[model samples]
Target: MTAKEIFDSTIKEIEPLYGNDEARSIAFSLLEHIGIMKTAVLAHQPMETDTSILQKWIERLKKYEPLQYILGETSFYKRTFRVNSSVLIPRPETEELMEWIIRDFGSVEEDFSEKPAVTIMDIGTGSACIAVTLAKEIAESEVFAMDISEEALKIAKENALRNNANISFLKQDILHDFIFQTPLDIVVSNPPYVTENEKSAMQANVLNYEPHLALFVPNEKPQLFYQRIATFAKKYLKPTGVCYLELNANLAHQTAELFDKEGFTEIIIKKDLSGNNRMLRAAL
Candidate 1:
């Protein structure tokens, strides 16, 4: 079959599942992954077509499986991080959090302090995207990432090595262990913020494919993770240290309130590109 024929048929096949924008994104990604550029596929009659793979791809999309899982990697902070069902696929909003950290800390090379190393810990660090990225960017950063899921910690460790980011991977539950003898310069997290009641508000691709443990909290306690992390930050973080978190847009105020009760000062809410209050920053 011709490449254009394959392209058109693929779009026609998946457009009903996702709208034109997402369908075309999936189509173009598949084309690029298979080494057939859009113009080449359009110009040439045949561009080394693979029927079986194409059929399987279409079937998966029909089930609303995230393309990141299908592709086994996603772009984050101008770098690629491998992803799977074991970890939540890193999202663009998470990138904004990373950017905020990078901006706030500034580069170590730019700092003239003789003691330049900054200690950072990412709680519930799924995929280690934040830990790894900070390690790579901050230059003089000593980073640690923690996750309860052994599978997720495995992937996070792999990503740290994949990016050559040199972050320490610890398999620990943040909810259990609150000990930090050495105070942290920064603590960041994007822990489970979605409440059980909000499940209906999420897309099928997210609700079905993403790991529930990484995405949700009980209905009665919508801010459980934030509460725990914020309270921990009060004890573990340095007097001048800061914490950054990704917040559920619906509960930004509540998350900030949690920080305030923990005696965290300068509690502020920041919005993503969509203008939704999606991040919170606090200091002790």
Candidate 2:
């Protein structure tokens, strides 16, 4: 079949699962991934292409599998990072968190040579998207990323190398006490904030395909990671160091309160593009 036929058929098959706009978007992405241009498909041009791979991707899409996991990589903070079921796909809100850090610490015109070294750690560095982006965008940043899952760390390491972002990867659970060789200028995370109860509200693509260990906390203690992060920041963060976190919209205030109780004086919650309370900045 031609590119147009493949694209239209893929969209038709998945439209019920993803809705009109997203289905079209996914279909276009699948075609582009296989070397068919959107322009050709749109113009009804009959571009010859492989059908077997396309059919397989379409089958997965019908099952509501995330396209990023299917493609094995995604664009985050304008850079491509490899992703798999081992790690959660990087979200736009995380990019906003990165932007906030870059705005505060990065200069568009300066490179590492002119800036003093800063130490930053990502507590749950699933895919290392946050760590790699900071290491690339912020000059002279010594970045460390920690994840409990060795499989996730393997993918994260590959991403760091792929982007040429020098980062140290550690396989450690943040819930347990860990040692940092030096004080940190920033502690950042987009950790597991979703409670088990929230699973029903999430799309099947995310609920079924994304890594649950990276996405969820027990319903009884929804604030588990944030609590640990607060304690970790108190112990390891420098007096002037800051913490940036991507928060669950429903638990934003409670998460900030955890930092507040930890004596983070300058606690501020920031919203994402949709204006949900999605990010928090805290400092001593």
Candidate 3:
């Protein structure tokens, strides 16, 4: 069959669940995964490929499974990272959080050899996207990533190795008390901020396919992770260090207040491309 035929058929099968625009996007991505480019598909090029694998993907999509999980990978900050049911898929908003940190610390002209190594820790580091990206993008950065799930940490380690980013992996539950041997220059996290009440508003693709432990908190304590992060920042972050977090837009102000109560004098809430208050920067 032709690439266009496969693309159109896949879209038709899943359009009801994802809508036309999203279905088209997903179809294009699936085709690209099989070495079929969008241009070739659109140009009506005939392609020879395995049909059974494509059929399996279509079946998963019909069940509201995420395409990233089906493909076993996704692109984050221009780098590919492996993902599965064990980890939450990295979102674009998280990229903005990485950018904010990079903008503050990254320099192309400066000699990193003359400066001390920038110490960074990523809490609840699912696929290690944030940790690995920071280690690769910033020169002379020593990175550490922690996650509660053993499976998630395994995937995170593979991503770190694949990207050739040096990171120390820790299996930790941030809700519990923990200690670090050295002071940190930066602490960053995109921890579980979505409350149980918000689950109804999310799409099936996310709710069904992604790891719930990394995506939600009790509705009564929506700021649970934020509170712990603020407390950890107070204890571990250096006097000149900063903390970066990806916020739940609906509770941005409330989350910021946690940092303020922790005596973080400087707090900045930055909006994502959608103009939602989605990123926070706090400093001691």
Q: Which candidate achieves the best lDDT against the true structure? A: 3
**Rank by lDDT (best first):** 3, 2, 1
All-Cα superposition RMSD per candidate = 1.6, 1.5, 1.5
Tens digits of per-residue lDDT, candidate 2, 48-108, equal 6777898898898878888999999999999999999999999888989999999988744
Q: Put down candidate 3 lDDT per residue, 1-284, tens digits, no spaces.
A: 89999999989988998899999999998888888899998799998977677788999988988888999999999899999999999989999888899999984346788889999999999999999999988889999999999999999999999999889999989999977887999999998989898899999888887899999999889999999998888899899999999999999999888889889978999999999999999999
Model 2 per-residue lDDT at 20: 94
Residue runs of model 1 more than 4 Å from their true location after superposition: 108-115
Evaluated against the true structure, the overall lDDT of model 2 is 0.90
Using all chains and alpha carbons, the TM-scores for the candidates as numbered come to 0.95, 0.95, 0.95
**Model 2, residue pairs in steric clash:** none
What does the lDDT read for residue 129 in candidate 3? 96
What's model 2's lDDT at 222?
Answer: 94
Colliding pairs, model 1:
none
Q: Which stretches of candidate 3 lie over 4 Å from their true place?
A: 108-110
